[model samples]
Target: MSSPALLPLCLLLLGLAAPVLAEEAPTPAPETPAAPAAVAPALERSQEQQQALMRQLPAEQQKTLQAGDESFLALLMPAARAKAAGTVVLVPGDGESADWPNVVAPVRQQLPTFGWQTISLSLPDPYDPVVAIEQDTAPADTDAQANSEQAAPPVTGGSGTAPAAPTQAEAGSGEPAQAAVAPVDPEAAANAQATRVLARIAAGIDLALQQGASPIVLVGHGTGAYWAARYLAEKEPAEVKQLVLIDAREPQGMPPRLDATMGKTDLQIADLVHAPGAAAQRRKERAAQKANKGYRQIDLPVIPGDRAAEQEQTVRRLRAWLDRLPPAASGSPAAS
Candidate 1:
């Protein structure tokens, strides 16, 4: 071959050989992603706590009741005497168990002796359920990249001032994608709590009726009073004839006011106001006055340093009030 032609052929051969050499070099394998760690399911705070509590209580007192989608615990003490006086469903306040020591425990234990069948319910915690979730921490690689960028000398322009690296908005646009969770709605959470509480209360009442007990009276303590009153005013169950509220306070941040709720029903009502200065206003409220001729608001003196005595005194007053009512009008579960 001539020299110029031979040179051209050699260049062509090298070009083909270069691609063959590059293809022979080993390529790195892709990395497999790490598996996600297991996460526990979210649970309602009150239900979880109460389930643990129910295990410690006596089996005899424990009653598993179902209401709507929820199953909850109730403590029942049948009438101590042969002749049943009546049934009283006790609804405890927020942060209290069915066997709460203060008013609920004492009343449920002692009331049966006075010929009353008592059942105390566990109320849900008035808050949104906590979700068990894992947050994505900033990737270690991201931090390393950020640090490397910060440490590097900026690229310069002809003017000598370094060209702008990148605006914050521009840099953020390339950030790795993350999980997006919507914020919980407060109104929806509150409504769910109210519905759950009301269902539990109704279940307790149904249990009493099933046992063939009559003259079912709903007694609510603390915020529970609001739930009980609201149930009565709304359901107007023919079986329940009276309501007793002890140290009653409406559930915070929600409601038809307790007074307005009371006004909706004509059932016999008693407001056992424990807070000083509350009795007078509760007495004058048009709701209470218009409720039934039987509505009465009585101020209770707090027995400081003696919880037992205070509970005893409250029970005594309740017993006396029951004695005043005419015999439960002929709606015994046995007769029905």
Candidate 2:
């Protein structure tokens, strides 16, 4: 119906519109895979717990110490009387806090009444879990069972032609091949932990010295004893003249064992052990006594379910031991 020139123009406009429409409708970009979320370190959790505990403590008694990038909690119980015997640096064992209800809290609270200042520290949790979780069946075992069933030939009602037996290659390779496991170096981990713990101990010693405490004593409970003994053996600070261990035990992955750690140190040590049938612990104490001239061992009766009695007896024995140490130089208080 239109003129010949108009038809050419219309064709040109339609061709232009077709190209524009094609350009507007482009393909969508591919989605990127999300990165795995970073996990919080185990130490962070312990620090969080420590912070919560610090909130519950009395402001006057609470103390915060900075060791490297981390801050640790310490509780200071000043002497009830004017003249303090000396400051006893208390390091709690694994799973214990600065004011743990067990021996740690009791000792820290009672020692001050006897004219001794107590500084209790909150130590880190064990690197490994104390009890491993059990699973019903391992993935590898399940896969192995499935592969064996698949490899077995099926039973037939009537055997016209028996199924061909599986080839040796197929049978041997049926189970998924296991990947090689990486080796772990326990000593390296222990050494790293020891380094951190030493820094904290040094900080505590500095605090004691600042308060004019003389003849500082390092007291460690359970695994903490190992740390105190190891620190004394390695650093041998002149200010810290004595070490006391209560219900002592070695930490996991630490080398040289508890007795060996105590034996190597020349510092005067009072090794106290409770509970029955502790043949191994007693033997180790004996070895340390034989090796070190200043080593003393005390066996206390374990009164289960009677925490007060146990703490009382322990304090009594410890007080007696402290009394026996050669009197400190004139004007210098002795360590308890």
Candidate 3:
């Protein structure tokens, strides 16, 4: 009934009202699922335990070295004699502190008595959750198999015919077969860890150089030996004149085993192995010796009850070996 001239004004009013109506309309709220439960950080727990142990170390002997953003704990034992022959940088194996209970701590504390300064390092833990999770799930699969066997009727003898192959659906559904399951690669994580460890070792070596410890020696116990040998072979540092490995063993998932590293390097190497059950290690060392003329292999007797005597014998043998090597150039500092 409105006039034609009012039509344009009416359309404009309706257009403006459309937005207002929309603004008044309520929108349905988005659904959010419940939050996940909190889980404790395993790495933090391990660090806390190490920190507690570090705090208990002697105030004078305990020292911290910066490696990237993280600070590593080190224990320094001065030589007992007036003039130190040379400094020995000790690297402990996995889950071992600067002053580990076994070979690491004993060597560090006792070597000082023989006129050699010792610096021991605390290394990272070897625990890998990816590997552990795979191992834990294995038991559950075994239990399921046992249940299936018990549920089936017992047969006096096995049938001549073989069981039928699994269907596509059966194979794909539920938990996958052990052989079908693809294990998570821990190589990246392990490489990162190795890098961090090497940084710490370099820092320790720098400190020793600053202290004027010439003709420096790198001593590694257990898997620590692998790290030490690898460092010398890879870096080819001139300051480190000798490499000593005590019961050296390669770490799992690490490339270029102990023997491979030893064989490639031309540095003065003393490969010490604990007798009995060390046949493989001995054979590897012998092979390396053929390639490296400077290599020397020493077989150490393991005394079960007399640990003190065993360590003394070890120190004596190490001292004799060091005495045979040419002394550092007179008036030459290690840093140079």
Best by TM-score: 1
Write down the worst ten-residue block by lDDT for model 3: 175-184
Using all chains and alpha carbons, the TM-scores for the candidates as numbered come to 0.72, 0.67, 0.67
> Candidate 3, residues 191-278: lDDT per residue as tens digits?
7777887888898898788767566888898889999988987887777868888877778777767777776677777778776355
Clashing pairs in 3: none
lDDT values for all models: 0.77, 0.74, 0.74
1 versus 3: better lDDT goes to:
1
Predicted candidate 2 versus true structure: per-residue lDDT over 2-74, tens digit per residue: 6987999999999989978998998799999798799966665557668877788888888888776767888
| Runs in model 2 lying further than 4 Å from the true structure | 1-45, 129-184, 276-291, 329-336
